[model samples]
Target: MTHPQIIARCHPALEALLPKPTAARAALPDWLRAMPSEAPAETLNGDPVRTLKHCPPFLDALSLGILIPLATDLHFDKGAVSWDWDPPALPDTLISRSPIALHLPEQATGAPYPLAVNSILKFLNFWTLEAPSGTSLLFTHPLNREELPFRTLSGVVDCDLFRDGYVHFPALWLDRDFTGTLPAGTPIAQVIPLPRSAPPELTVTTMTEAQITANRALQTDLATTPGTYRKRFRH
Candidate 1:
């Protein structure tokens, strides 16, 4: 089957500071790429599907989206936000400074807003996502990653029609006690491109007798032969 293509671009000035979109496979962390020391077992740990490197779909989604990075050093001190940078005025001199990432004065639009239902929201958009005609871009937090100090709010943009405008990201800074430099090149979002067609119909059913037998056989194979899924089932 043919694969769909997602195109990523940026302003000429940001071309160097920001990373061009790359195949998700290239972004896999070294730890995820390494195989587990123990051999396959009957449990989830032994299963290659949970073993990180052997999971294809998860890795494939990661390859989507233009990876945006911090343009400067950002620091949060207790409830106060502060940073140290050269020229000390890049936000004023630069292309676009996302107010969502900064601590603005009370009178400014950059001021933070707290929500009663969930976490607070800020106006932190930094990237513009686009897909081919008849497609859209889904922006979300990286899948299965809980180590980061912030969570990006999920969004869907009809990029094919909105290519000229930039969509900013509003993040909920999770680590209130966080302090120090959130260095540049740190991945801040994952963008997935999908077709804009309507959702397909869904069907649900119980397993048939033959399917039950097949599952039993597969279970026996999994117990007897390690990596059965890795060797045969995984695409």
Candidate 2:
């Protein structure tokens, strides 16, 4: 099926520095790219929840949205921060003038939040994300990316009407002691475009006897066959 497109726009100065966002499903790891293992090897200390929920396809699809990467290397030393633009950029350029602007806690958080820290700051990565006439852009942290030192707050923007405006990512600093180089091209946010139509009405009811029997039979088949879901069920 043909789907709508999500366009990424940037300043002329950043045309060469920052490439457009890429498809998240492309160039996935071998384990995810490969077919489901018929006789999968279990780890010595594997959690059942992880084993079940953290399947290759599941994790891959969660990350199968879109990714926006950083344009320059960022370094945080003690209280001083610096931005090192990769090549093309002059050394004398103002490092303090950050492309990723900072938003005050009050600006991000509507009401007076009662956090212990008095000076809470968030980094707002710049991106002009646009979608079709009736769609909005949904932003969130990349799935299974625990190594990153920050967490992007989830948000949705009505990009269809607000396409001209830039959508900035508000991220909380999770690791304070992280004083290394955050290399350029490191993905800072994952975005998904969703239609803004009215959602389907909720209908709750008891399962029919036939459905119950079918579900039980399917459960039994899954219990007996290792690749029942992957081979027989999944399209």
Q: TM-score of every model?
A: 0.71, 0.75
Q: Assess candidate 1 and give its lDDT.
A: 0.60
What's the lDDT for candidate 2? 0.66
- The number of clashing residue pairs in model 2 is 0
Q: Please identify model 1 stretches exceeding 4 Å from their true place.
A: 30-36, 39-66, 84-95, 98-126
Best by lDDT: 2
Q: Pull out the clashing pairs in model 2.
A: none
Worst 10 residues of 1 by lDDT: 85-94
lDDT of 1 by residue, 64-87 (tens): 545555544566665455545332
